[model samples]
Target chain A: MGRPSAGKSTLASHVEDQLVEAGYPIENLDGDDIRKHLHPDLGFSREDRRTNNRRTAYIAKLLNRNDIPVIVGMITPFRDSQEQARDIIEDEGEFVQIYVKCSVEAAEERDPKGLYQQAREKNIEKFTGVNHPFQEPLNPEIIVDTEAQSIDDCVDDVMTQLETLGVLDERLDDDYSFSITRSEEQDITERLEELGYLEE
Target chain B: MGRPSAGKSTLASHVEDQLVEAGYPIENLDGDDIRKHLHPDLGFSREDRRTNNRRTAYIAKLLNRNDIPVIVGMITPFRDSQEQARDIIEDEGEFVQIYVKCSVEAAEERDPKGLYQQAREKNIEKFTGVNHPFQEPLNPEIIVDTEAQSIDDCVDDVMTQLETLGVLDERLDDDYSFSITRSEEQDITERLEELGYLEE
Candidate 1:
């Protein structure tokens, strides 16, 4: 979780693509995507923000429980809301909270969505790190300082954390090592093409 | 989807359990559960109901895109919202609209959540089928008449629909015939026990 323009969605999508390349099926749950499709009526009120975070958390937990890892990118500003999500998801699967740290000034200068300008101009209400406060996570599993690191480096940091947590490269046993073979890759590609999910 | 006490959750959960038993990992998106955990700020307003339905549909689409089938049980009172859900999900995966049909009288009589009585006594506002309207689907993929059929029969009807849609028991080609055998089951059970998800 991080402020706007901190590259949360970019990092999450990068991780999802890398996981797919590693033969792991994963899903990208972006805050903007969820808001566009799921909770269009939700405003930026505190209650609405909490509800949206909880919504994303519930979907992530469901996907994780089904053996599909999910990369969630959201501005989970409230500590309580983030903790609530952790409590719910950690019951079924691991909840690795990654704090994408960036200064408000840096985020405003980046202005990825122009949201910071809107908040600065008083055009938007309850904007995180602008008008509203964003409580930093006290105990995040990983912290990638966006101001000091490139996007690739930040993604590498997250991947390293996941590896340490035994999420990626989970070797079952010496006798049961698993890896994607050339034929399996070809089969997956063929299936994707047949399903119209990809072009031949 | 049907009225508040139309037994949608029970039916959906049963179907999910059956799918698990059939070696398919599935997720059940329940209206009440989502309201409790995800959409706590949502009320019975028409806009809120539409947002909730769209929210569930988005999550279902995400899960389905990740190769996990989803069974959604929501009192989707608006035809436009249902159509919107179909449009969103059908783009990625199959969208089977199951209209669980039951009489308003029967639903009120069941009063599963005691909500029907509240609606009848004017204690609840914007209650679907009482204070508000529940627009029936113009062309649902399947219709299970809860008033006429037993729960088992209703589930059977849904299973048959899925089978006809080629969603269930899809024994893949010989080249990729994947199934969990007895030893695999034992291994999985042992892993779950070790992970403290099952009794030791």
Candidate 2:
């Protein structure tokens, strides 16, 4: 869980691809998919945000009960909502809170969906980190500063943290293609963001 | 899937318990639970029923992709919705259509939730099997006549069919407690039904 445009979805998707290639039973509950499919009725209000977090955590619990680990990228702006999600998911399996940290200035500058622009210009109601507050994580198990690192670096940080937490076996680790930095990696990633990829 | 009061939820719950006892990776998405948790905004209209069916099938697909079989007991009252669900789930794994057959007369006679009474006397709008139509399964993999047989027999039939489909290994099969016809079985089942256990 992190702030809006904190590189949560981009990093989560890459980490999921890396783990899946190693034959791990893992799923990526991408924020875009969740918003389009599950909670279309939810708004950006604080209570609605809490409801969304609680619902996503319930889905994670459902998958975890079957021994399938899940990666969810949600902009949980409330401390109470994050705690509720942790309590819900930890009942079935481990709830690893990874804080993708990005400052307001950096996030606004890298506004993939133009949400920040709308929030600033039109003054969208209940916009996180703009009109509403974005509470920092209380005790995150892992922290990836996206403002200081590239997307690949952020994903690698999460993967390494998962290994340290014993969620991934070291023997199965290898040179994942996503880890190798290339010109196409940086170029296409920027283009994809413009096309509204990983805007969550 | 089956019509309302067709013993779908009760039989599915029993089958889930039996399979889980044998250490099978299976999950039961009971109808009442689904209604209470996921789609409370949905009404008893035809389009809403189809939406509910589609959503449940997507969840089954998510679990099936991770190699966890799901048992969903929903009142899919439209043929197109059932086909849509099958198409969604088949993309991940085998989709078994279980038709719990019970006549409207029998179901009304055994109405546990007084829904039939309300539909007949007070005229609840869009009630399936009353005002709304419940399209019969076109080609169900397994059909259990709940009106003719007991709930234990219905569950046993599904288990046998699953084994025939090779979804369950013969070596792991055993005499489950749910299969045993104790006095508590019939008595408790009836009592629970009155308490709105399988009203779905």
Candidate 3:
């Protein structure tokens, strides 16, 4: 995880695709995507950030528990929270922390949302690596420099690390396939009826 | 919206069934169901709880954006969070906050997971209405007392509220529709690829 505009989401998406292509079933937990859809009530304050991290970690852990490797892309700035996440998903080799590292200057240059400009102009507060501190990882399993590396090179680095860690077994490589099965509308209807969220 | 073990899920499910029976399309975002699948990594921490709340709100917002009235069944203990959720949707009367109010004693008597017993024994921390606080709504659009209300009564209450809110327009009530016709698997794959989480 890294700061906004650090190519964390870009890197996470690329890695997810490669893993899927390689035949390992995978799920992704994009922090922004979740914010837009899943947890819209939360803000971007310190408390909200911690809350977002915890919730994302929990979702990742759940997918991992179900035998799906989860790739989480979020700006997890604090080591304490990361450690807590690691502790929560304690399955051997299940937690893989990949730090997408980049300098503030480099990140600013690639600011897709002009966030750096906003932060510099004081339009945005608590901008990580600017107004806010981004704690460096003490021992991240892998690190990818977004500014210096190409997307393909970054993907290769992650794939190499996963291979060394035995996360991508040979059987998985041979069986890399995906399917789109429609959940029966009736099933959803029945479930909604049971939950009391819908009207009878 | 209902209390724990107060048959909130049961009530929500009945409502969904009724809506479908009347030919309205619906989706259920039950807290327990989401906990099992969507957000497995989240814990009972305050931050995590808020994140979970936000995620649910976001999903509800997405459904609303797509012209589907989502039925969310989480306790959603904070009024501020609920207000923020309302702001996120901003689709007039789209959010129907239903309080499934129940007494601590009544909840303890049910003890679906022996959670109350654990809280009493000091084995569980942050138990809502026990060690932790559960802020009741000052004015929920709909309030259902699970202890005194039958499942049908609770369901009817919600159905009436939805009708009053105009969520179930005559056209929608007679149309059997599916908002998400494509499998989430494809969307997940596409998102993974776009976010660069895939290892290609």
Q: Per-residue error at A65 for model 1, in Å?
A: 1.8
Per-residue lDDT over B23-50 for candidate 3, one digit per residue giving the tens place of the 0 to 100 score: 5557777888877655677888788777
After superposing candidate 1, which stretches have Cα over 4 Å from the reference?
A114-126, A171-200, B169-200
lDDT of candidate 2 over B75-189, digit per residue (tens): 8989999899989999988899999999999999988998999999866888788888999989999999999999998888888788777667523334342333333344776
Q: DockQ for all models, in order?
A: 0.66, 0.37, 0.15
- Candidate 2, residue B37: lDDT: 68
Provide the RMSD of all predictions against the true structure, rounded to 1 decimal. Answer: 8.4, 12.6, 14.7
Model 2 chain A — which ten-residue stretch has the worst lDDT? A175-184
Ranking, TM-score, top scorer first: 1, 2, 3
Question: Which structure among the candidates has the greatest TM-score?
Answer: 1
Stretches > 4 Å off in candidate 2: A21-23, A41-47, A123-126, A163-200, B21-23, B121-125, B169-200
The predicted structure with the larger DockQ, 2 or 3, is 2
Q: How should the candidates be ordered by DockQ, best one leading?
A: 1, 2, 3
Candidate 3 Cα deviation (angstroms), residue B91:
19
Docking class of 2: acceptable
TM-score of chain A of 1: 0.85
Residue-level lDDT tens digits of model 1 in B1-200: 87777889988988888778766778887787888877677798888888788778877888888878888899899999989999989978888888999999999888878998888799998999998999999999889998899999998888778777665644332223765343345578889988999964
TM of chain B vs. native, candidate 2: 0.83
Q: List the residue pairs that clash in candidate 1.
A: none
